[model samples]
Target: MTVTATKFTPEVMLSAPRRSPGVPNPSGKLVLYTIRVLDIESGNSELLTEDPEAGCPVWVGEEKVLYLKTDSRGNTTFIVRSVKSPEPESYDIGKINAPLSDLKVKKLPSGNIALACSALVNPDGELVNPETDKKPLSSAKVYTSLFVRHWDTWNSDRKRSIFYGALGEEDGKLVLLGNTLTNALGGTNLSSPVPPFGDSADFDIGPSGLVFVAKDPELDPATYTKTDLYFIPLKTFTEPQAPAPRIIKTPGLEGYSQTPVFSHCGTKVAFTRMHSRQYESDKTRLILVPDINNPDVTEEFYATEDGAGGWDSRPEAIAWGLDDSHLYVSAEFHGRRMLFQLPSTPSKATQFPKLIETPKGSVVGFSVLHRPGSETTVTTADILFVSSTSLIDNSCYSIAHPGTLECRLISSTSKEGKSFGLSRSQVDSIWFSGAGDYDVHAWVVRPSTFSKDSKKKYPLAMLIHGGPQGAWNDSWSTRWNPAVFAEQGYVVVCPNPTGSTGYGQDFEDAITGNWGGRPYQDLVRCFEWIEQNMPEVDTDRAVALGASYGGFMINWIQGQPLGRKFKALVCHDGVFSTLNQWATEELFFPIHDFEGTLYENRAAYEKWDPARFANEWATPELIIHSELDYRLPVTEGLAAFNVLQAKKVPSKLLVFPDENHWVLKPENSLVWHREVLGWINKYSGVEEEQKSN
Candidate 1:
């Protein structure tokens, strides 16, 4: 069969069907994932449902599946469909008081299926329905707390919490028990599933109880990342009074607690915990509670002989082996998100995790597939179904054998890269000596039409990643995609410098209070390496782009000697001044990164302040910020643009009123790409070719 390759444009990337993590059925014969079902053995896939508003598909039992479908009017319906039946059974849950999402279900011991979903509720634990509930005549919001506003929105009297009810059958019709849903966190004045990015992963439901993570209400949310794990015992779906949730304390581990997974038997729980309260980028240690009934007895599985000498990579997501003897974890390694396996039980001797060899690209998520009757055994039949993506592929699923440590491709979004004119060969990397004489890794993505034998050279696009602690992983991304830039006739180079994760803790810690020091020098060396080594890259016609901390670097670069190297620059939601960063929502981020509060450590902030060196800013730049970006705030972008305009430097400012830290909406994303690419291309001379075409 002959297939035609197409240019991977912004529209193509945006219009592509998004693939979500899938859940496997109890039998493991079929996978209920990505709005489709795949027969594992036959390798045949069929759409299970279709709708832009449909999501959160979960398996109810071996033969049944449940999901939620919301209409344009904001009304949600609970859908239950049998694998054998042609039609699905749906019950109108009616219009929730707030936005309802993150559906989870667990079959109770009494044969009743308990359903839990998250939504906003008032301080009194009553559902907060902006559409149907009464509101004061004034639109003004008064807040006396630290978090008057969060990531993108202003704080209200309502908080995001979990609501629970039983899915039952009455008179041959599926219905919600008690004809109403009760807030699982009712009367607690606590919000489960933390804000902004938290989802179903923040809480898990088991036969015995529900486990969730919530920030300590007494602490200021803006300053502390301390969230405790809480367990709520469940007996009846409809209880007269919801039992007060008990905090599962992990002594000496007070940072962010996340991803609580219940053992298959519901007797134990496994989660990840960080040690520091202020640093959000601390190493996540795998934590295990052998007995849920005795929550105080917690064990740290991957601890070092001393306190800080052992494994350094932060575990992102974790899953347990079917037998619960082994735990599977995914963490950033070098530049890839690698999967590792470790014994679930604590060891007397120093122990390290074993690496599981998987396909190229990072493992986004995975599900343990246990064959029928093999749930209690560590057999070869048990497969870890992993979902991953790379710079070339949007989605790919592979079946990994735990025993052999071998991975085989099962299916992908498309047959091959030919479908989108992308190839794995075009994705390459290099290691160079950077600041501090340490080896720094950088990914180099060449255009699909790139050829070393050809006389043509491609313009250089230097892409910087955010997190400052985040690395440019070998993973797919819709926003700030290197492929998008490479396809535009630019050789995209993304450097994982100091402060980047996947390296060691000391490397990541080097960025603390040295935001513009080592990392900036690393980028300078990376640019020089490409210039001196790659004859196919036109470094003279180069452009640099970044967002968040990366954006901060662009602003920082505009004042350094490196500013003269870039032909053009793009800063998305970057910091304008280190001292003014106190206006950000998450104070802990700047506090920890800068080493202390602004008042307590004014010199640290002043040392790295980009505004201090604004006199050297002469680069033609494009500044992008969103009105809702509480993390960096719109003022940061405006402040940078103001300085540029005052100096009469060629510059443009683009602001999205509706977006937060990212341009998420499809239409908005298209505009973002067009403006950013057009600006950079014009300065890099690629615009002339585009105009002629």
Candidate 2:
């Protein structure tokens, strides 16, 4: 079959289907969704709703689906539809008066439904209008605050408040009850979905109608970025007073505690918490509260003890089995992000957690299906699904319950019969022995036009992954795609060396304070392994490129003895000096905890500082940075480029003033690819005709 490369341009988002535990569907069919719903049993799909701008559908009960839809006027309205019914009932929650942020539906034990929403309102308990509401400290033009500017927006006084509203149907029309539970208490900057770093995993509700909020209550972002859990008795009525919210303090006093999940029996609440309050890189451990009402009685629950991706080992998503005896966790390990099952009450002291087998890719999200009266929770396995992607294929599938080995393809619903016009490239994994006798893994994507029988030597491009802690798993990426390099007739090799997650914790921890040691050696070994085993690779014409931590390694690589191996280098948002990078946002924890503060461990910082080894740098380099990237700060890129210029080395600097860390915008990304590709072609001496498709 002739293969062609196609640029993907669809904006698709899928959400995990929500269903009440122990509730029998009776149909025994599974619904996979991606803007449309596919019934797996019959291999048929029916359009639920399509407005071009609609949120994920939430299961209100066994029969009803609730979701938010926005109209052409930019006004959003809530719609509820019965699964078997054709017409949908719409509710206007006065969005113009109090615009909702994160809307969620919860069922109380009393069988009543309530909506938990976040709205940006003023101190006067009214929705803050950007056009009308006066700014805080009206006279001062230059105001000072820690979170004054986060990501892309300036912080304002219009704080988000969690509101509770009882849902019911009156005369066939949906009626909402109760005012904002938090509005009356002097509007707080309480975010339902915490800003900057929080996800849908930040909060959850129990059958008792107790809504738990994981929020950072107006802390100075510069010094502290801590989020604690707070609970409020959900008001299911319009008239009666709502109870004040109470705090559920964890032992990690200064750290964050979030993604609260209530047990099926509501007897236990499990959440993810960080150990240190200020450091985002601190180990994230699972914490269980026997009684959330008495949160201090908490114990450490070890499910991701194998270590989640470098930063932490906390589960991103959680759900309990119908019998409530097993908890399913979606965690990152090795290079793949997969699901794991932890016995609610483990009988053995040394029985490690059981991994739910799936494809070698990221398990983006999952949902659990259980009958109302099942004999055991063993049948309550998560319908673990992964939007699996590799260097060539972009498909999604759900592993069958009971026997996770059965991989069922559900990509039909998502593709909707549209062909990508892309051919699958020849992909394989290669392992090599590296520093400390450790096995390093690298993913190799062969050029689309090449074959093993051709015996042609293809130019190689070694792509380094960032996170120094993050692994290059079998996943699809819009940025740093190996396929793009392969499309240009270059062999791509992405390795997960020491310090990369997914390997055991001991291996990941090896590069904590010693970033330039084993990881560099592993990269060198990976390169040598490829040149030796893969006769189709042209090692003399190879180039190395990376972003963020990967970018840092590129700088480190140029100073190492292996520097001469690469013809050229590309670094984006890379770290140049540890001492100079101390002021970058969100890196405080890892720099302080792992390497100790600059004052305490000056030698460690200087030992691996790329800026210090400028005299040894001779490779032609391309440095890219973004002004909005406070994480690494654009200064790091500027310093690296200045050093190259001063050393009389061939170099070019690309700055994206409007972008952050990663070049996200379509136009900016095009420029990034063109510039980097152009650089590789020039330095590697590849002809113009061979560089483009």
Candidate 3:
């Protein structure tokens, strides 16, 4: 009998990575997140919190834990109590009426406490009344953002939704960052907005107020994206007085404003931006702003760099050693994601990022990785990352030792484990011929157990990625379903053709207006490669699969001269007409907008639309889409399906009721996999002996 690992199991019981380890209290012992109390330990850990469902936790003292609890009022009431000293007694000291993100707690050098939280929807950062259901108090109305999930992965300790951003300039002459946020009033008291680059999520400050800032990204109208840095001045804000911040500005920053960050020594600041292809990153530049808080005199914009730039290299994670000798920043260059080491001295070129981890095994290289530096250096670490492996689904690592940057497995929803699994892939790379003599690249995986002695050529499947610029990266794809197929005796291949990124910017640009031509050749070439190189792959029985842009490609391929090569095609939420796509509510990705707009690029749109070529289609196809998909809305799939059905082609359309661009939730994902499998089996003939074996 075919054996699937009994069933799926999650790996850890801890909270999500987006939620951070609670900041340690002054004595350096206690840490709390949610309802539970946490204690620092030296080795591998076990959950220590006593209360269940206690979401946000923080360390208050060596013997105490402070956590946020929603008292029917909807306000997150902060409670501090002794976890070690006996009776489990705790006191409710205060609460923030405003919704918050990246809540932080730290013991001050003076033995007092520093609490920092950001408010997004309401500027006044008013706390929510869970009991009364009152809205946040703010003059500026918050945008009912539909793109919230895309921009943030933060969870709130209270009713207000939370978002994370990096730090920016202006602190008490010292540098520091801890999850920075848009205060309820959308105003940061002292620091500027996060710069344009770097990624931020649920965050917490360092122990005893030593940690100070969080690096976030914001746009610079002049330069595009600049990393804006921010921090809470715990030492100064410890008084009864609320924080009073001085507004600071840099050279060329007269007009544009966005994400920002600060350097370790408090001497420099960095920023990032998402620029149209027109503005490529040059180098990391440092602009000096007057230290108005300092008695030192005159200062105008003196643009200078220690030569080690903070440019193109968008700063994601900023790690400052206890002594401030080593600095770490995460950056993506070429096809590999890496970490760069910035020396305490300005003269040295920022050292290239040392690779900590990749999809699986030894990451031959990386496309993106984020590591947060700390006084703990190689030992203590917190990292949030997106890998070709993780695909845009961000993953995290807590207590990431520089020794092993891999994060700890923790899911906020459950205390259960086994959420992630490591699977083995056999093909390093597969090559195949296209329309002409051109070639395509693909990676193939066989079922967990296979034998050359067996005569059965397995049923085959292909996975197509969206971005005409997006290429298939080697990573764990919860949706890719290759492993699940392999578990069911099907061989899987994912191809990266001419239009994909990671290969190079030029390769990506090549398909800008030529989507229907050369890129199509690459897809065909990949299939041929599978037929020729993968002897175990049944050439006659295969399926064409893709989503989003890939979905568009699949429909376009059906009308190609060699369209009948595959008997089955699976199109998942793809675009059928450039005209309809342009008219949709979806906000196009930056590069897509830059190439051309609907009005100006109409000719290219017509040439790229598969709907025009639908008459040439002859193969059977299956369509899957989300009713709420605005990106490559359901209309595209509907149009293609209608034409196919009208033409009398065997075609079917499946719509997910409550999903979007991507399907979420564990149970939904499981069903999705099953649906795709059933589609393949119903259309492509699976050998009976193969299923039994």
Candidate 4:
């Protein structure tokens, strides 16, 4: 029996199964990944462990795996299970005293496993347990420096630090060597797996030692993006005392450092670096340390000239090839996040990395797979990657060979969208001449029911992406998804204008100091191009929506001549007044984008201040802000709402007290989608269209 498909709604998207990146075992024949163990050859998957709380599985060897299991009381335990046996062994490392996650394991020379995970720790380097720890006499926090608040959370005494200890068997039971884990950054006044968004990816464990990225303690976190690599040499997990970590400095690369991936040999490290100290969106240059023993020697792979002379796209997450002769890098190219292969060592002959084609989607995550004892041989290796499109949630594939670039499918979650009536054919793209004679790109997602022969006109949902530096890639996103708007009988258009990534460094830099200039002009051109080229779109019933920088642009557009073209607008956590942006925690972002500090660059802020032209905001707008969004702050939304109310403009305000810069919680997100869609539908005549039908 064939069941008719239903409209793709927020509920379907939110209920989709979330799959983690695949981690291949030592032999590459089996995968201990996500929540299930997959047999690569047989194409069979089974539950990794019976315990529901056990997750973040890391391969201990060919047949054994180690994972973390946290109870309802917030107490975490390390569990090691074997594929051959149903019973798993539990290890009691004593009271970690805090919630721990992101488990990583490395084999020690002493035939024991060295385990590491990130945990929130107090000043004295002890794990912080809010459940059992003593409560403060008063709810008060004093700040002497910057970073009083960041992202969504206010400053606290506890820091997210890496805790490590040795795992060995004793008296027929698994136990931590010291019965307690050692804080790697203890007494250093620094945090690893840096706050807000960092995870196990920020650090890597290898045979030689542990290398992690951390911001300089001397500098103010609120104003700088200078995160340096720190290395701690641990020859064996049985060290009596935790050694002091030393900084691995890259002379010219002074910006943010990320994804310090240690080579298979563990003697070297390859990571991405940005040159500009203040610019967060600068080009991420690939950097390599020849030897961890000698930290001073570093080389730049695929080296490009300072400003536009060489290869230009930013390299994201990286992994070492099987033979260590090459590196696999996933980066944004045009509209998709493509994977590329580059030499592990610096090559003067190579101008650009070789692109390795995969499925039609962004390469979200990838790892190199090698057969056991075949690390030195290049023939027995493959690249396992996770790909996803705007329509497909995620699909796992393995590139059989780098030479052939043959991608063999392993598994996929794409079938889950079938019942929701989604298809890849609904997604397309268009390029138009934008400001500064640059060709700007925009994605066009048509409704599932749309047909060229129908003569039906769909309302326009102009989605302006955030980051101003970020692009609307052909990737799956739970937030600001074009498909959701398309399902509501609208033609969703997402533009990658000036200051968007994956294009080039110069194009992205064009909007640094000219926030309301080139980008705005490009957006205007995008709208005009849509009207002129797309016959199926209803320009008269259009709505604009954005968040963060996009939200700021929406507010900016509210006071511009373009505001009259759209029937309504939606701004999520946008900036109201450029002068009051100092209230943001990341001062470096505004400093770099606006050209200077608020006090020193008042003219620049005043030039793009949306508050200055609030009188011109006549378009009916829906403003959404979260109380925890320290990046823009709720006050920004309230300020915009107050102005709209004062001017007697038709507007509505939706506030989420628990959400941050983005609506992350599933329930809250559902509400967000409903309210946003309802507001846009009411103005775009969708509500009227439904009633008339």
Which one wins on TM-score? 1
User: Could you give candidate 2's per-residue lDDT for residues 428-541 as a string of tens digits?
Assistant: 778899887678888887665678788768888999998866789876676777767765778889899997777765676688788888899898888889878988899999
Off by over 4 Å in 2: 1-34, 42-53, 61-63, 69-76, 81-99, 121-149, 152-161, 179-192, 210-226, 235-244, 249-254, 302-314, 346-350, 370-391, 412-425, 685-693
Winner on TM-score between 1 and 2 is 1
lDDT of 4 by residue, 535-647 (tens): 99999999999999999999999999999999999999999998888999989999999999988888999999899889899999999999989999899999999999999
Q: List the residue pairs that clash in candidate 1.
A: 97-129
What tens-digit string does per-residue lDDT give for candidate 1 at 582-642?
9988999999999999999999999999999999999999999999898898999999999
Query: Tens-digit lDDT track for model 3 on 1-693?
Result: 112234222211111232332343444333343343444443222344455434556555456555556544445555555665345666655554533334555444444454555433433543344456555576443434322222112122232322222222233111123322223212442222231221223223332121122222242122233322233333433333324332343333322222233333444433332323222322233222223233122222212344233343333334443334444555444333445444434444344345544333112111112223334444224332311223222232223334465644322211211232223433355666655554556666666556677886887777777876666654344566455565556777877776665454455556766778778877767776667777888868877788887888888888886568787888888877776764344234422533566677677678777888777988988888887675566677788888889999988888887787787666667666667767777666754454665
Can you give the lDDT of residue 206 in candidate 2? 68
In model 4, residue pairs whose N, Cα or C atoms come closer than 3 Å (at least 3 residues apart or on different chains), thus clashing, are 547-551
Q: Please tell me which predicted candidate would have the highest lDDT against the true structure.
A: 1
- List residue ranges in candidate 4 displaced over 4 A: 1-5, 49-52, 84-95, 169-175, 304-309, 379-381, 385-389, 394-400
Compared with the true structure, the alpha-carbon lDDT of candidate 1 equals 0.85
For each candidate, the alpha-carbon lDDT, in order, equals 0.85, 0.66, 0.49, 0.83
